[model samples]
Target: MFSERRERLRERCSGAGVDAALVSAPANVRWLTGVPGAEALLLERDRALIAVAHPARDRDEAIEELVVPPGQDPAVAVATAAHAELLGVEEHDLTVARHRAVTDAAHCRLRDLHHAVEQLRVVKDDQELACLRIAAEIADQALGELLESILVGRSERHLAMELERRMVDHGADGPAFPVRVGAGDHSGRARHLPGDRRVEEGDFLTVSLGACYRGYRSSATRTFVVGLAPQDWQVELHGIVFAAQRAARETLAVGTSLDDCARAAGRVLEARGYPPELDEGVGHGVGLDVEEEPRPGALEPWPGEFGKLENRVPVTVGLGVALPGRGGVRIEDTLVVRPSEDGGPELLTITTKELLAL
Candidate 1:
């Protein structure tokens, strides 16, 4: 599985006129070599070598021991062994002290391979998609269990902690991001930190979370009324946010631009007379990192601005409505962009979108 990825990276190196490239980014190294330790890959024209603190091993075999002098840098040893003319390293991932040592050992010009591997990872292949799907399933299961339990009077921090524990119990390596549990007036704040605020009967409860499975992550969010009956405004706000989220999800496709998706949700919110006050991006790419590439919306635009969506790129569509003192609602899901002919977008997070009274 990883051999193909390494070959593709090698081809990229050759095309970029780099005689040899070193991958040190943990995610990039895992993607290439399937080794889940502190490791680096040295890619040359005709061969590739992986250097690790521990000995290397075949992807399908047990690790083999190697002899190395104490206190020697694995990267320097790999560079020397490969006999590279020009050593390309990920400047962003490598530390200044490490970079200096690598340059001193190589005795060759060091080039920055900035985000080259990340750019390659933006598009998901079959195996990556499968991992993400499992991640979503784990998150959904955890959330489902949370809803089944009595939520009244529990502190937001406690709930968040419980969700994380449940995700870990359900085969997740860990929580993808901080579990967000906003109660009462705290609901709908983007990236809201969970506090000690206790859940109240009349408050609106919003929870946003995800699970990491096999290094891939998926996210989902839902809002519910904490009491026996919701106020009319709560219902109205939830309905509006739900419609906006649905519109955004429906508009996601391979050819759709990031701006278009944001606009689609924005138009719904605007039409409902509750446009977002703080203009955070509506959604973003998800993979190895909780948030990655292809950020959506005019808000928080990247250096090149929101780019076009590509097929097989997984992203989250999150729409939030924060109504000051009255709290708010947020609904989100992770989806894979696909061609319209192939059934539009593939929704990975399948938790129910309906607002429920907890």
Candidate 2:
């Protein structure tokens, strides 16, 4: 798989009119070489070279490894050793100083590799999907365990810490990202910092979390009322978010435009009298990085540029609304885009989307 990936990258470099390419992004490096922590990968037409500070614990013998001496930049060393007239570098990842150093050390002209590796990673193979499935399972298990315990008096910080610990206990490398626990007025915010605010009766509690397993990640979010029965407004809000998320998920088919998916969900929220400004897109591709490519509503490379969803790509559809004084609701899930004949999108996060009254 690693060799195949390198060959594809070489093809891309050739098409870009470069003789060789240097990949320095950690996620890109791992995706191409299956060796984590590699500082850089220099891909030639017939050979591949990796530079690192120390030998990897599990090494791949197909590529030649170069151990950098103390205080040496691995990227510079790789560039110095490349035997090509035109070399492609990940321009977005390399610092200006580092790029200057690499240029000074290299005997070749440099070209931007721009997001080539990231674009290649948008689709997943069977092994990658298996890893993502396990990651989602771990997240679900951790959240399920947390729900069974008492939560009324728990502080947001305590809940966040506990959820992260629980994910680790259930066989995860770590929380994919920091576990988010929002209570009362803090609930439903896109990204919240856990604080001393304790969950109170009738308060809305939103928890967003994911687990990283074998380099893949899964994200999920759920909101619950802290009392025996949820308020009418709470139920209504949860229903709107839930319906919006479902609409987005349903729009995820092979060749479906990414903007259309976001619009499907946004229209629902707008119809419910929420603000017309749906900042975060309905979802985005997820893999080695929690959020990678094929992003809807992304501002980078310019907005409305996320082309379309392809089959076998894992993505997350997350949407929510936050009222200033009153709490709100968020519903998110990780799923793999698939053709309708293949049962549509395969939902990795299986936690119930119901408005649970704790």
Candidate 3:
């Protein structure tokens, strides 16, 4: 599987007029070699070599590797052994100092690879999708268990920690990202850090989290009321966001631009008297990293601002609206884009979007 990814990357490099390629981004290296600890990959026309700090911890026998001496840069070590006249490097992954060191180490001109591997990663294989499915399942299991427990009087920080622990308990490597728990006024804010604020009756409680399973990641967010029932206003707000999020999710077809998705969601919110800026963007790609490629933000007029959705590419459709001084609602889910004949978009995060009353 990893070898096939390398062949595709080499094809990308050859198409770009490079004799060899050096992949330094940890995620890209992992994608190419299937070893999370691999730091760099040197890809030549007929050979591939991985560089690592501790080769013994996690080794792939199928690929050759070199253990760099302590305090030495792996990219520089890999570049020093290159056998090509021109090397393509991930410009976004290398720092100026590291790039200069690599330049000095290799007697070859460097060309910017420029997210070539990421573009390759946008469409996932069956194995990759399997890992992502497990990740989403773990996150959903953890969140569901949390909902069944008593949440009143719990601090946001406490809830966040508990969620992370739960994901691990449910067979995840770890939380995909820091678990975000927001209560009352903090609810529905994007990336809201957990705080000392405790949950109260009738308060809105928003929990956003994901799980990392076999290097793949998933994201989901759900909001609930602390009391036995939701207020009329709370119900109304949740309904609006739910409709908006569904609108965005329904737009996840092959060739649908991110802006179109965001606009679809925005229109639903605007029709209900919400601001067009209720959400910065509709969603983003989700894979090895919690958030990866094809990110779409706001309704920018620029053509092809974030590119179009592709089949087999997993993404998150998250939307939220936070009313200042009052609690709000946010709902998000990780889904894989599939053609309608293939069952349309596959929703990985199975947690119910209903505005639950705890």
lDDT of every model, 2 decimals: 0.82, 0.89, 0.90
> Which candidate would rank higher by TM-score, 1 or 2?
2
Flag regions of model 2 displaced more than 4 Å. 69-71, 297-306
Query: Which pairs, if any, clash in model 3?
Result: none
TM-scores of the candidates in the order shown: 0.89, 0.95, 0.95
The clash tally of candidate 1 reads 0
Instruction: Report the number of the highest-lDDT candidate.
Output: 3
User: Rank order by lDDT, top first?
Assistant: 3, 2, 1
Minimum summed lDDT over a 10-residue window in model 3 is located at 297-306
Candidate 2 residue 64 C-alpha distance from true site, Å: 1.6
lDDT of 2 by residue, 1-358 (tens): 9999999999888998999998988889888988776888999998889998888787787988999987998899998889999899988899999999999888779999878899889899999999999999999999999999999889999999999999999999999999999999999988899999999999999999999998888999999999899989998999998898889889989988667888999888889888746678777889988988877745344343457788999999888988899979988999999999999999999999999888
Where model 1 places Cα greater than 4 Å from the true spot, the runs are: 51-82, 276-278, 297-306
Could you give candidate 1's per-residue lDDT for residues 226-311 as a string of tens digits? Answer: 87889999989999989988888898887787567778888888888875443566688899888877775543323553477889
